[model samples]
Target: MRAVILAGGQGTRLKPYTAVLPKPLMPVGDMPIVEILIRQLQSNGVDRITFALGHLAHLVQAVLGNGKRYGVEIDYSIEDKRLGTSGPLSLIRDLNETFLVLNGDVLTDLDFLDITRFHADQKSTITIACHKRSVNIDYGVIHRDGFRVTEYEEKPVIELYVSMGVYVFEPAVLSYVDPETYLDFPDLVNRLIHKNEQVKIYPYDGIWFDLGRFEDFNRVHEIWDDLKPKILSHE
Candidate 1:
């Protein structure tokens, strides 16, 4: 199977580090973030990958270099300009079959093979990998019914399901994405939903982290040695 990684983001949230290096090239353990993702995909039976690159594209290419060292065939789709998330996929003409798409900065133990199979079984045009998250309100939130004041819940935590930036998309879904336009994944999903297209979501309850911020980067560094063995066992 082929996987397309969105590795071109400017990663503004990660300042000094990203100033010198692309977010995907930032070190997590002993390897760069994109390298870890490539290794994980290799372990999961995916050996062909296309990296959608923009900011500091050459540096990423130089570091990864055809992916032969990692047991994968690596190619790149250089974006002349920033093409949000889904927009980059439109540039990859070879993805006529179902393929996996993910953000390079995400660290997860999700089973890619399982997600691919699930997408096929469900016959969904797009399958999003979702995770449940909770947000707590700092103050009491009042629920009002008409003019009467209803019950007030103090510091209630709301549970919400969100995309983990991992997706399985059939080629048919490409019709929904506009070529040469900047579009985010969420907007594409919304368009699919509005058109009554089958857009399924597979929930994952596993080890996952988005190393987009300084705190997350530091957190991964702290747990690198402990998590490396389990996540990179095949390497």
Candidate 2:
């Protein structure tokens, strides 16, 4: 199976560390975050992996080096300019069938095979891995009507299903990507949906962490020794 890992984004939330290293190269135990991702993918039947790189591309190349040590066929799609998520897809070559796209900075045990099967069975142009997250407000929220307080919800919790930065795309979806255009996954999904094209979500109930912020990075650092064994397939 083939997988495209998005490793280019400058993780603004991760600041200093990302200033020196690409977000995917940030440490997530003894190995770089992307290393775990690669090993997991390799163990999960992803034989060929392509990294879409931009910021600090040279360092990434220096470190990974064609993925030989990791036991996978590695390739790269360098972004001369910053291309938002799906925009990089337009630059990658020879994507003629259903394939996987995922964020390199993610820590998850999501079963790629199951989702790929789901995408094929549904025949969807795109399948997003979704996770349910609950956000809690720190302050009370007030609802008012004509300067009168109708109700007050004290620190209400909001629940939402958010993309885990994992996706499966069929070849037909590429037509929606215009060459050299700045397109994101959401933009592509909306276009497909508007056209009545098949776009679906594979809801996941599993460990999913994105090392995009210090809080997330710190959380993983705190628990990864125990957590890593559970999430990584190759380990």
Candidate 3:
């Protein structure tokens, strides 16, 4: 299987830490997050990996060095200009089969092979891996019918299914990508929907974290010893 790791963003949200290193290169538990991801992919049946790179591309190249260390083949697709998440895929050639695309800074135990098989079994144009997250609202939320208040809830916890920045795509879905245009994943999903293509969601209730966010980054560090075994476990 093949996988594309999106490691290009400047990681503006990470500030000083990212100022010196690319977001994917940011260390978590003594290893670069992307390196850990590479190892996970290899364990999950991915032998070929491509890095969609931009900001600090050289540093990433220097650090990962062709993926041999992880027992996977690594290549790079550097963007001349900023291509939104999905745009880089259009620039990458030879994706004539089902493939995986995900953000490099993701830390999750979701089985890559399992999702790939799920996509194939469903015969979907794209399958997005989603996770359930709860967001707590601090203020009382009022539901009104015109001017009359119908309901009110105090400090409600809202449940939402959020993208885990991982996806399995069939080659047929590439028809929606325009090589000249910059596009993000959501917009591509919308386009697929507009065209009546099948898009599916694979909901996961596993331990997952988007290390791009500072809070998750810090939390991972706090719980690394407990989480590392599971995150990197081949089982």
Top candidate (TM-score): 1
| Sort order, lDDT high to low | 3, 1, 2
Clashes of each: 0, 0, 0
- Candidate lDDT scores, in order, read 0.89, 0.89, 0.92
Give lDDT tens digits, candidate 2, residues 119-194: 9999888999999999999999999998999999999999999999999988888899999788888898999999
The all-Cα superposition gives candidate 2 an RMSD in Å to the true structure of 2.1
Model 2: worst 10 consecutive residues (lDDT sum): 226-235
Error of 2 at 139 (Å): 5.5
lDDT for model 1: 0.89
TM-score to native of every candidate shown: 0.96, 0.92, 0.96
RMSD for all candidates, in order, please: 1.1, 2.1, 1.3
Give the TM-score (vs. native) of candidate 2. Answer: 0.92
Cα deviation at 88, candidate 2, in Å, is 0.6
Residue-level error in angstroms, candidate 2, position 36: 0.5
> Model 1, which residues run further than 4 Å from truth?
none
Estimate the TM-score for candidate 3. Answer: 0.96
CA shift of 111, model 3, Å: 0.9
Candidate 3 local distance difference test against the native: 0.92
